[model samples]
Target: MCSCQQHSTATSVATLAPNGAISFRVEDMTCGHCAGTIKQAIEGRIPGALVTADPASKLVNVQGSADFAAIKSAVVAAGYTPSAEPIG
Candidate 1:
């Protein structure tokens, strides 16, 4: 029960993106390392793009002209499952 409580607490600590940024929920990211990998993967596919993630919130914010499909693909390539909904 303690572990379950801890997990719930951690999940509640995630941060959401500020207004005007494109955001999505990534299901498989469990830590900072996963976030870093996701960021790298996005930047690799779309150079000069900005990517940020809050693992607790399971939210990923990407700043760029890349379409939703490209962003989704990048997240998938980075080993995380990304949803298509934009968190405005």
Candidate 2:
């Protein structure tokens, strides 16, 4: 539903890799504005956190020394549902 008009078939669940990168699938993110808002929310809570949100993919990737709970909480605080992808 991204206003940017781009669409993607990325996975619809969040994942935390061994390297410490966290990936979240936010189905509600539907535009650059939404992405920005999500980014601000995460970055605001987790200092030095790097967030890359793609509305097209409804995916938000976070990198840095951050707690997974904190990251999810920030996103939830911003009013979005972030689903965690299972790690294999």
Candidate 3:
């Protein structure tokens, strides 16, 4: 007999938390390099931006004066799939 099971990927919609903080779910972030690249990409585009990425959870939190579109674009530019909706 064979048992079959399918793994489910968590679905997260990133929205503004507080004080201009946002979280994004990046699917391709699997290592520190990826995280660092993402951080740099975002900070480079948005000055005074703080980015924290968790490879284990595949989530990146950005806080400061940054536009959500740029943030998502930065993740894409850094080569990762990001899932989020900007809080306008």
lDDT winner = 2
Each model's lDDT? 0.66, 0.76, 0.73
Where is model 2 poorest over a 10-residue stretch in terms of lDDT?
A: 1-10
- Write one digit per residue (lDDT tens) for candidate 1, span 17-73: 565556777766767777788888888898667888887866788887346678778
lDDT of 3 by residue, 1-88 (tens): 0012222334457766666688777766777777788888899988888999887787888988557888888777766667767554
In model 1, the clashing pairs are 14-57
Q: How big is the RMSD of model 2?
A: 4.2
Question: How many residue pairs of model 1 clash at the backbone?
Answer: 1
Query: Where's the lowest-lDDT run of ten residues in candidate 3?
Result: 1-10
Overall local distance difference test of candidate 3: 0.73
Pairs in clash, predicted candidate 2: 2-30, 14-85
TM-score of each: 0.71, 0.76, 0.76
